[model samples]
Target: MRAGHLLLSRSSLSHLLLIFTLLSTFTAASFVRSRAPSPQRTAGAASRRDLISDTVENILHPVIHFAPTVLGISINNKGLQLDNGTNPNDPVQVSQALQTQPPPIDLGQLLQDITPNYNTSKTLDSACSAIHTALPNNDYVGRVCTTPECIQSTTHYYNARQAGNRPACVTYPTSSQDVVTIMKLLREYDVTYAIKAVGHSTGYNFTTALGFSSTTGILIDMSKMKAVSYDASTGIARWEPGQSWGELATTMAQYGAQVVGGRLGAVGPGLSFGGGISWYSGQVGFASDTTHAFEIVLADGTFIIATQDNQYSDLWWAAKVGMNSFGIITAVHSRTLPGTTTYGGSVIFPTDKMLDVLGAYANWINGGADKCKKGFVLPAITDFFVESLITRLNIFEFFFDGTDPGECFKDFNIINTLYDDRKVQPYPDFLNKALTNQQFVFSGFNNALYSSVTDLINKDQLLAIYNAWEEYSVQTSGAYLQNTLSFSVITKTGLAASQANGGNAMGVSGGDGYLWVCYAEGSIPAIGALMDTKLFGLTPQAAQAVPKSQRKLPLYANYARLEQKPFLTYGGIELLRQIKKKYDPDNFISSHTTGHDFY
Candidate 1:
């Protein structure tokens, strides 16, 4: 502890001082908006803004009490006050905020957090023991399965390559309170952990992993909290983080309604928060747009609700695509719509017409995309590749909430096909068919490179992406198994749908770009993982071909490779960092959790 600076060995005093200044001054909205002003101040005007509010008084009150540690403080009639003569409860004075080249801090003392370096087993034991004793009844699901096969099974993800990294323990919470208890213990112990909601995430350390020093020590599987309830009057549906789209779709069908959810049945909330792309996305926008409320647990174990109209509205917009930075969401409440039946199915084209299909697919999204009736309700569409031991086929999965096979979809009729199963069926049945054989038989370690691009490139560019995938598929034909490169448009209509719901972390706007989904599938023991990354055309040289303005953020977090930091691609990564600090002051999240290092 030092009197004139924040002296801690972990970081420099100046940097720490600067950080504290930003954390105590800037609002969460400042960092995330695409056109937001920079934090740097000019000498002329001392414009100021308040970052804290009475709602979060409990969090910042201690900071005020400890102001003397870095900014200096003194006792006064109103209580503990800053030495700078500012009101402790008044809005922070930005005019007195830190400058670009901040001077040495003058304080009476320093406060430091517990170091992240600790014995992994001891911390894990402590966390698990506390959770076990606290939730001793049917609500808790905590275990340390020693069997190799069982440990191996828990690691299985949509992509099989991510299956081998197991953590020391797995704990499932039955309710938000359980999450609050578990988070408190883990944060207290400074334990690194991963979160798994059905293991659909392909990114490493996202769900669970083993090395404590390297990122994984504990895995918090959110499976036991599967509860879904719908209110007919309000037309709102609430679901636990663990529930899958398949389960929700089927259940909501009984109520003659449906929530904007995953296209493939197995996807859970992680994708929803990461700008969830769906078969219904064209009209409904991202499934995440449907999210109206989130019951979340902050790093400090404080359970709070983040919504558009609340005091935490900034956090609400940030959480839209900020992933786990804001908190661990326990329940997501979204409005449901009437009419769940849809007409469409898979149409398989011969391998000879691959080029034709790719070209036509490009045309469908580029020129004919406007055929969307309401501009928002798009004819559900997906074209992908299915490859197995001896078979390779191109399939187009289509659907629409309406009865007719709309003209917007008639473009597919141009190509000769083998099996065409387009028909009118319930939404649940449509997604059930999406749970195809490939997911079961040949699924393993895989990576998806998704992005929002300026527009659909030429057939040649699209072919290049596919050709690269094909080459990799041929090379690692045995290890990774199958891969497909597909594209989905985020048309003007879809963009509005998302914007109407408080927007999200994705900086994309209508007319800005098309969402590209490039995925590679294979069995365990990945031979194509590296090549899977290369197929995206996200490399520096590849991105250079596009105009600077059109160079969109690379891969979606859910579909990104292990090394990718999708949060940085967001326009508000800095705002997300400030929000992280406000909620996770002790740096517990960066030390103990995986995915997107906000700072």
Candidate 2:
């Protein structure tokens, strides 16, 4: 994490800048955190102060001194190198360093191993050949990886799929026209393909292989299609598929226009098309709720504009959380408003207050009057338990239009007061780097388990879940309960709009506010069963009286395991099937039928 620097006081800001410069002038703590052996997982494995101190001493300090003399490179606390002067030899040195460490995993090698033999099927062969012919000669899509690597590398799916298998080939679509062309290829070849934007699926559900399709068939990558156009006079934005929430925020900020997007900007626009939720979602509506129109490429290789006024409005409803069962979404036109400069940052709270903290969070989401208008949506989250000693409560707090820190102080103080030991830092600085700089055991993929309780916002339920999480993690050692809490006045919009297309299983009707409590943690084999059993497979049950109908479906695509029937959970099982038949009768996109079938 970047030093706890904010645009707060002059001294603090200056110290932050000085520290930033000093750290930059040196090149010591490589983003590698060294992990000590753990006996069993435990909460007291590493204290926050200890971790912070070690990060400064081991990583930051060395890079600070060694940088100018040996490497002649200046790196910021976040490890972004600043070039004082150009050195052609620097490329060779940097290349050697990267080669020594390499990225965590190789995407091509993993694909070749996990992919079925090249002789798998005619459909796969035909689809792969077509994809290979489509790519322009570029290192990004070199001769080795036909289509899969292009998607995997750019989308960072290799990072996500390490917990599972990687796709063999990835296909790039230059535009909505290209998307339709690829769909026709899939239909003619009778091959299955995965339609992905952002590729930030959370769990095993969305990314997992559902049908009998080989890896080489198709991995439809839309990263290149990221284009954003806005008409300030029209108060609307036409956003292309592969765009991320961060890109949207930065882009819109330039025009002083804002759309409801999430803190994790890298998690593409595909997420919003599937029922977008954001910190601002509570007041404005889920990201999808703000969507006015969608330019879609359906299974029949036909491109159509679908909206409330469009001819295919039924298909529009099903697209909310239908996964890829429908077709590819090329662009989304969403209502936009003036952007705000004033924003809130990520907050850290003491570990002892997890239950009370989350309970208070549940209460706040249910009753934080006028906060959403100012863009205050706090998604409570817990980050890595870096050695069983420290797990930071990472909260994504937002403010929409208000710039006065004084205006946001009440909310900030309320949350900070929850714990005597709290650290407040700007959101941008916090997310610009990894959690620790030690030789930490970095997992190939980070998985987040999430469930939303909308109608029944019970304090006891929140507390019970927290207590259960603590008890569970205490035994497991490596795992901890992380949460992201969002409550919105737009609950009615989500409920009404979810059924507008074809409806979904994300039971979010008549909810006062939405509470999405998620548990996100990462670990290596040294932690063993603690990472798998306690972290991976524990079902959280807080209130037995509450039915499952009140919960919003899980948000990120990868977080939902295949059996979760995510399409149904987000809206409804039956509606998903109907939309599947209507838009993609051939099921070109994945239809995860482990147990829950769309139709």
Candidate 3:
């Protein structure tokens, strides 16, 4: 683009808005097939034809920020294409003599000529065919699997989008080099592919294969890549993306070190990249903050070691905190700290105690700096299960970093409880529990939840939100399966700890503690879509109940709806653009994957 580029006409603006609205609803029609490019870009530079193609590209593929559409010119099987000129893959220029007259080389066989090993055409077949075809030839066929044994290995991600859907074929990579080979194959064939770690992610495309029908993309499962090692002298732990926090904790217990990570036994690398929130956050910080570097494979089948100081440092920092983008991380060398026994446990209370419990939680978070700082601490996590529209159970899943329950649990001790399970446990033993409320929301239930800043919320406001959840759950319980509401506290201790050891990218202001209000709905497939609409809607309504002066809601991307734009709240779109430009200059991969928008 020059001093001035062609501004999108009012007519084009109208078209974009229409497309956005249509895409807002989950309909196949909204995802139009990308059209093929023209036979040749015979026009000269900055010609009227070039500008038209550039303008159309901006409208069709909108990013957080669209740089001047370079030229979408390429020489693929179709010929000298020039539809999306700014496409980084496009050739900069062709010899002047060649552009004037087309060569006699057969266009039909041209694609294979460039990449002879790949499929000559985008063959219309299940992704299984591609996987089967590549198996015997690639060196990784021993790890390549179409057998039930291999597929059965990843049955744990209970969400339907993850567990129910299966990939056409699963390729297990044992190392970063294996991933590079897989990436090259996928790119050569132009096949849609997805990368899976510990199957806990929620999206259909993220954990399974992609397809126009179903089961199309070849899945790269990272389970076998669970190679873990550590350099005690350097305090750096090399963890394959597939390793779980629980597994790592047990391993580190032997070494007297711990890697900050998700509290659950199954939470894996994907969440690690999405700002891993852990119980230890109050004592240390976010899991991502301890990430020393990343071994990543870029979209173009290139490998780079990204560190805070590496040439690809921008990509490293971006992947650490942001949603999936730019590349697939193979392994993360994370920093570790001394491991020790921690104390805390669960207490049970009736639903009626919510008001009192929330008030106490608010007070606990509002308490002074020393109690909430990066030292000995106790953080509270609650799971309020809606046993019925009329009855609720409050379970306090609180913890302290030391071997004894200190005064931090004082606010909660006063509340009468039906049972007490608090006790001191080794770090590895405590990390085994994954605190999801499974008693109410089962494996089969389709669920979604939202989190809002709790500092502005009080006990009365929380009770109102609970009331809304109860009402919705009651109305839908008859038609659907069930629904529930829960609360988790991220005290100032955790907030301040997130800023420790180089800080993390959770996108929160440092040094202040707040409550995270969480609501979950579980239902049958028929009403799952409806539940999603309602669940996403009620989040803001819950926030609005807070006084206008105090209302500042930043939805956690980890818990947000698919359509929700959470990246913007993390920081700014401007920074997102600068990094994307440096990393994925060629707009090849981002569009095919799931995550929030680039922002």
lDDT at 294, model 2: 79
Task: List model 1 lDDT by residue over 1-599, tens digit each.
Answer: 12112224535654665455333322121211111221221111222322234456446454533443454422111211133653222212211221111212211112111112122365666676676687675222223234443343344455443444434456667899988988887877777777777556655543343221122356677777788899999998888878678888898898899988776776667878777877667666778787778889988899999888898877777777766666788998887878887876766666567778778776666655545532221221112121112134455677676677567666667888756777888988887664232232223334344443334466666665555445444433323223454456666667777777666776666564464544545321212334344444444333343456665654566666544566777666777777778877877876676666554
Cα lDDT, all candidates: 0.55, 0.47, 0.52
For lDDT, candidate 1 versus 2, the one ahead is 1
* Predicted structure with the largest TM-score when compared to the true one: 1
Write down the worst ten-residue block by lDDT for model 1: 106-115
What candidate 2 gets wrong by more than 4 Å, as runs, is: 1-119, 132-143, 146-155, 162-168, 203-216, 353-356, 369-373, 379-383, 394-400, 404-443, 452-454, 479-507, 525-533, 542-559, 570-576, 591-599
- lDDT by residue for model 2 (405-518), tens: 444334345544322221333332222221211111122333344443335366676555555554544444322212222233334443444345333345455445455544
Kindly report which residue stretches of model 3 are placed more than 4 angstroms away from their true locations once superposed.
1-146, 153-156, 163-166, 204-215, 368-391, 434-442, 454-456, 478-482, 491-493, 500-506, 548-553
- Which number leads on lDDT? 1
Candidate 1 segments whose C-alpha is farther than 4 A from its true place: 1-120, 138-153, 205-216, 373-390, 435-454, 526-549
lDDT for model 1, please.
Answer: 0.55
For each candidate, C-alpha RMSD in Å? 22.3, 13.2, 20.2
